[model samples]
Target: MEIILWIGFYFLTFYAFLPALVSRIFGFRVFTKGRSDSGIALTFDDGPDPEYTPKMLDLLKRHGAKATFFVVGENAEKYPEIVARIHEEGHILGIHNYVHHMNWFMRPSTVKRQIDQTSDLIKRITGTRPLYYRPPWGILNVFDYANLGYLQIVLWTSLFGDWRKKIGPDKLYRRMKQKLKPGQVFLLHDCGSTFGADRDAPANTLSALTKILDDGKEKGYRFIGIDEMIAVTEQAKKKNKSRQAAKGSEARGQEERVAERKSSIGPIKKIVVSLWMLWEKLFHVLFKLRPVGDAHFFNYRVRRYSGPPLDLRNDRTLRSGDHIMEIHFENQMLFEMGMKSKTSLQLAIRIIREIEKTLPDLARELAVVPKGDQVKALYGVSMIHRGSEGLGFETFELPKGLFARLTNVYLRFLIRVIHPTGNQRVREHSDTLNPRMLIMERNTLLEWADESRPNRRPNRERPVESSL
Candidate 1:
């Protein structure tokens, strides 16, 4: 608990107070300021708000100044007219993120969805893709850097807490004036999330922006946009590229040494790979099985069942000593009873036969109920399969007997030690018919079970981005 608290505290302090430092260290070199002579590039976040954006625009127009608005994608879609007007009025449209959630908390997929969706919407309306992205709350993770590599990341150099309601307009102006430096990027909020505390952000920020613009005009700080900031960043990167070029000769020598080392290890690596292949071949020979059409598919050829035979006639629990049995067969009747249809019973019988022919280990004690059924018991897990177009698999349960306890034990270990496979374990689907059960994770008989074959294909989810 204490460790968690410490981590949480550290995260809050780092992101809240040292965002630029964090970004710099994490390989996300967001522009915290424009060029020293470019004056402060003005930018607004979470806007084009109907109530305050038009008013803000009028103020900017009257002041004869230009600023960038990093508008949310959802809001942009909600009010494309406002987005179109922002583009028409000559303000730079940067993506502030689709939703106003903090960047630190979002997954890579969510971030991608947010940026791509928002950029597409803005581009559709304005015919220009966004070139700049300002992370919400100036907090970013490593994944954000990797994903947002194409766009220039912009962070603020100066912020006067305009979002806090307690900070009055005069104080806000004073704070901005105090931090007002050449090339400083100003952090000011023009809107807040609908899910968050309103705090009258739009109104408060308008007042602060007014004070800054007026004071900035008097102080001769030219209000620029992200383009200037991008120029500065690119210029620096170009210089770094030039410096790195000076080390290219040494880098080539290092690459040559690496190639020589790889050449030395190449023969030994091939020998090891050959040995592994030989060992795999031996295992296949032991099972009298071979890889079928696909390299992944394994099938057995023998049918007489020369492997260890299973005794399935008894439901009695084998006893060891002290009223303690190594394996219990009780309470597992839930599976036998769970088979509601004849098809399910048939599938179970087929799965057991496959196990008997292929993997003869746990098949030793396997059994099916009812002597008239031809098969005494079913072994292995029953995976759910939906009708033909595709199918999905759920968890695999153990069969009956000592191996049932052992299978349960094995599964418990898998659950505890091995990482969960999640939905990736299953594939294929059909929506027209109700789902049915198919046994997965079998003996050498896996290739014989064609229903289980559908689980091998990959499942592509619905496209996240919609048609514009």
Candidate 2:
């Protein structure tokens, strides 16, 4: 019996718990929230209740609000008119399985059947197949990740206990109102027939929802369907990328013109730049680096600090395994700037100016990311040590080891390849060019971000350095 229990434990761990952990913690293969500036998504699940859904729809329509309803196949099949009404009313229809049941207890094939039946039923009623699926209670089993490739798995950003009558209208309304800001996906229910749910719980939800819609509308919030919300977020991302690319092109064009006046990039330097950029691309893919807002010069990835404990300002100590945002310079941009500069000093000053311009943007972006507040520090390693103190970074000598030695070799090679007077610069600064760790604690970064003047240039007296 003990052996059998162990086997079951392992089975549940691999087949159910592991996948849920990955989806919940890492957000792998899931759309939890959006990035809209004013759009809010209201998603309802286990719904199409005869009593509540129509009322909710009426309230939403009166407020000119659109929502997404993840209707159960059984419930939707029973109330096809409600499902049709949802579609005709210009709202999104998504799947919530055939019956309200957790995916953890279902086999991969069973989960597929639950989804297919619901999708086909929705299409039969509404004449449109759902491209989105929200598993019961937003829980996923192992196969749900790859098996549901045809459907986008949606989770929620804000989940009020609206499925319980114990939480009254006032409390639910207050909770919903708190999440009224943009890019929020709210989880609500329009049915209470599922296990452990109060049969009339959606009554309170409907009651609270009216006030939420009114409040949100008054605040200039657009209550959109999940599909529209996702679309808007994607559009925003594409627009940001386009803007950044345009700025990068403008900078590159200006730098190229400057380079033409001084010395054109040699064929060897061009080859090196190409190879270096290719490696940077691969590294970004491997590490899943995200850009710091619209900033063109830096990208970062959250990582566990595996080094020795280091005490920082603000009573913070980053021990081994603490989370940190590992910052990386956009190498190609730096190389382009280097090509434009006649001297290393000029390149260094330009780099400092860029950091001063972009650090606040980075701080703002990080402040919005999930678990961003838990990050211990922003960390990087660089050979350039000057002006770090002025820019609010603490510099530490990298412990002598194989990692440090390899970093030293790689950075030196990068300098030689990217710098115009690479050989001469290396000869002159060899003694002071060792790599050092640069760290900015979370509080200090936020403080600096609050104080940053994006339009201002770097102080000429204290030029900052780049973490190349």
Candidate 3:
């Protein structure tokens, strides 16, 4: 029974003591200002003026509004009546520190005394204690011995620059209203920057106030006191903390699920890579077997190449990517072939042809390629013999059979000719050769003992399908 009684007493003591201790240490002003809704908090510093304060108060009253005033302690004592009017009119009174001293230069006790006197003076005049405090010149570090934060620090987002002598109502209004956003605080002065409150600064503030208040009211915004705004902001903070905790848990769960899925898929990627390599090599061999040109056709037109040499057969292998073959001969004959390959085989064939055409005598040495199903995606091809640079890899999704059309066009670009003496100047031989030019050219050295060949019909005019 005694233990239970002790625990209850402890709980009660902590509940009662913690907030006051914290509030006293951190200062109430740090936490207790303004709402975050579509409201503006207007705070005016250094005032309780008999001249401009009354005019400002009357303007606010006409507009049915209230503001916070951080008054100098001495000024409040001088115009106690004006302070009372402000209190009665429902504007919050705040301390701007007695003497507005640069407390950082003063001793600790002097700083305390400055706050004490202003606080006392404000309470004496208004009957209600001032809940807000503003540091002189928006500064706190210079006055280190003077501690503040009696209520929330009310910082303004908009300044009218009314303190400058040159500013007029039009300039002030444009400057202030341009940044008038929801949940902003605006700072102005009713007194002190200039003399007697009837100066340019105070006058400009008064002039700009009416339009600002009217515009805000029409936009469905209500001005909030600093304390109320702080209360709303705290409530929103608590709600956000709760929402973030829930989202964090959901994010954690999703991350775990994704990790598990990736673990399951590790092996499948390896298999696809293996198959693509094998198909690439097979096509590379086919490209080597295909003949390039025939010498018999040169009777009709000069054939630039006698076809890829049989000795270079073993030197050919598939490479990856797109390729272009440019054939240049000492005889001034030129051929250009563009072949795009999605597979290694197509790329190897085009490279081989390019090499053969450019350096027909050295085709065997240049045709060497690696054997295997391990070659990956190729992006480009280059041939040393022709100095031809190929571009736009196999990844460029051109239409099927486009490479075939390119090949035919390249072959036709170069004329066929038989230079028996291998000279640049050739003698005209014949005109018009049959389409069986490849057969005649290949069989030129073969001894055909059986002459039982069937009679050939006239050449058929079959249409070739469009490659692209």
Candidate with maximal TM-score: 2
| lDDT (10s digit) by residue, model 3, range 221-279 | 77766665666777878888787677876776765664554344336432532343333
Runs of candidate 2 exceeding 4 Å displacement: 1-63, 69-82, 94-120, 127-221, 226-291, 296-311, 314-323, 330-354, 361-375, 413-431, 449-461, 465-468
- In order, the Cα lDDT scores of the candidates are 0.54, 0.82, 0.48
Judge candidate 1 at residue 218 and give its lDDT: 87
Q: Please, what's the RMSD in Å of model 1?
A: 27.0
For candidate 1, list the clashing residue pairs, or say none.
Answer: 310-364, 367-376, 367-377, 368-376, 368-377, 390-428, 390-429, 391-428, 391-429
Q: What TM-score should be assigned to candidate 2?
A: 0.56
List ranges where model 3 is wrong by over 4 Å.
1-35, 142-146, 149-151, 192-198, 251-468
Model 2 residue 65 CA deviation (Å) reads 3.2
Clashes of each: 9, 0, 21
Off by over 4 Å in 1: 1-21, 24-27, 193-199, 232-468
TM for every model, in the order presented, reads 0.46, 0.56, 0.46
Clashing pairs in 2: none
RMSD of each: 27.0, 8.7, 32.5
Which digits, one per residue and each the tens of the lDDT, describe model 1 over residues 1-468?
A: 999999988876664434434564333467775555536777888876778778888888888777789998878888899889888988888987898888767776888889999999998999999889988777776566678857888777666556667666766665666556577777776665545536476677778778878888888777777786667657877887888778777877765664554454447544653564454455444544422111112232322211133322233221212111011111112222222212333433433333223332222212111121122222222222222111111222233457555644433322221112211222121121122212222222223333446543222232111000
